[model samples]
Target: MRGLSWQIGLRYSMDRSGNQLVSFLSRLSMLGLILGVALLVVVLSVMNGFDQEMRSRILSLVPHITFQPWQQDRGDWQTLKAEVEQHPSVTAAAPFLQGNVMLIKGNAVEPSLLLGIDAAAERKVSRVGDFVDLGLLEGNREGLVLGDALAKKLGVEVGENISLGIPQSSDSNDVRFAKLPVLATVATGTELDQQLLLSSLETAARLLPSGQTLSLRVSIDDVFNAPRVAWELASVHGQDYIIRDWSQQFGNMYHAIQMSRKLVVIMLLAVVAVAIFNVVSTLVMVVNDKSADIAILRSQGASQGDILRIFLVYGAVIAGVGALAGGVLGVLLALGIGDIVAAIENALDMKLLQSDVYPINYLPSALRWGDIASVCGTAYVMSLVATLYPAWRASRMPPAEALRHG
Candidate 1:
């Protein structure tokens, strides 16, 4: 009967008292399968999390697209901003002036790039301002906002006066100097904290040399198609304007995430392959241990097809149980990874991801059903393949020879 094939295969895999080695091998194979699948799922989910953070946090802080005059300062920024938002793809636009300057707080002088922004308009295109508790440039003319790390380097605090020096190429070599107080110190937990200096556009107008060009920051509805959208905007704005996008500003990070994800998946798949290959060894030992029993079944009119089906079922059970357990475990781990990281951090009193080296200093993870399905499918296919050689050998065994040897 069909049920007899299933019964014999199941008994062979589970009969520990008769042959300890076969039972041990079966358990080892299942354990390997479980570990391999679980690891692949967790690693893939973490990569997915990183990709999401790249799009959400990093992309939100930077401009999806930027447009600037190739010739000189675009004094009519108000007009340009309005024109940019008219496009269906363009969601928001803001004006910004940026230049290099030296910051001086007593003897602690640091080189910095100062960004002059319209407080109200800048908020439309970027959430960098929201990361901080205080408005570093709000209502404070001739005041500066220092990034947390920059503030630490300067050894200064809010309401402290800092001097800014700009290079002035006059008839004689003279640098223009202006003094402004620190409006606020902000910790964005991004690379922006390293060398950012924020000031109101009006303050920058007085502090920097005359004729500094302003660049337009633009946000788009479709982030992935930013380059194409930016090019379209540039075409309408005229050829004299140059455009840049987040892809250029933060592409290395995005590309690294993608490349790492591909490489890791490949490596883990190999691990899964190795684990799956162990199924062959497991089935071989099971067939050997059950040779006499197999011969008995043959003598009792069991067909070769029945013998093959039995072993196949045995291997499938190992693979199916292992895969199901692993998939469940991996999803649970990935979803609760943030809490795990927090617990570890609290116990060790140390930070895992440093903000200076990474985009954000927190653990992020996401689990997708598609990834789990792939892991399970790969396991099932490999397990089925591993059973073929052993199952075939058992099916072709001569009942007389197997009986004589027994």
Candidate 2:
């Protein structure tokens, strides 16, 4: 009975002779499901890629945690750095001095965060050392390492001198200015390229009133655990110090990305659900058109359960084929989307992502099998559920009444 039902259901699904409208609607419903599932997969993969790129590019260069004195006077930074490094979660610690200042070159002026770092020590905590030769700032008190974007904006190049204007006090407008030569330029492919200025720890100390005591920048094994470790360090060895982490600086952006990803999932899932539900209309049309055939089958001793199973199989065939095709299309697109975007950018001779405005000037994609599986599975299940009402209606229709109507 099951084999007979399956064979008849498949034949009916393939037959387009009786009603052209029903066949067309069935194909349209399957097409909608395919498109919805494919788009969802591609979008989710891109979101995953963006999240990964942010962690690797921005978070890798920024300090995971920072410890600074609460008072204006510099504290014992060496002892603090050593203590931070002793923690099990801490990977490396480096000393740095930072100040908010303005850069001047000719008529152009830009605000920037002036960071002073010990080149060798910085290499342990940051990947900035890989981009620029921090060693150049060692003995050259007037040397600076500017982000490529900042240098371009200032119309300055390596060996060109730019003036650094540091405010004497937060309350007063008195500013101390010094001329420093650009030693090198670093391209980090992030927003840092717009407003970061790098110098030696000694030079940074000279620019600010805090002479010798520097703040410790710590890197940890797991970036997500930075807040807990920072608080622990603060409570134990930082009674006179303040604790800060990368989350304080970039948490909002990270959270925004996560929120957008979730919102996109919900919106796209609704689209998929709508497409799946379209199958209900298609199946209802099929049930009405096949009423006489169903009546004949019942007269031949086919049970109501057999009739229901036949339509269920018909719906499953449509959904299963669409899901499989969509998965294949989605996987191929996700795998090649990066190259496709790059080619489009090349042909258009334009940049979709500017490094100064966006992190890493390229569209990225990272396909996960789990996402594919979940999307396909959910779509198939929804499609099957949509078939239930129409299938039940067909199964319960009295054969005598159906034949009389036929």
Q: In candidate 2, what are the lDDT values of residues 263-377, reduced to their tens digit?
A: 9999999988888888888998899889999999999999999999899989998889878888888889988999999999999999888876666767778898998999999
Please give the TM-score that candidate 1 achieves against the real structure.
0.91
**Each model's TM-score, in the order given?**
0.91, 0.91
Off by over 4 Å in 2: 138-142, 210-212, 343-361, 404-406
In model 1, the worst 10-residue window by lDDT is 132-141
What TM-score does candidate 2 get on C-alpha atoms?
0.91
Q: Show the colliding residue pairs in model 1.
A: none
Candidate 2 lDDT at 21 equals 91
lDDT of 1 by residue, 260-351 (tens): 99999999988888888888887888888788988899999999999998988888788888889878888888888889998999999998
| Residue pairs clashing, model 2 | none
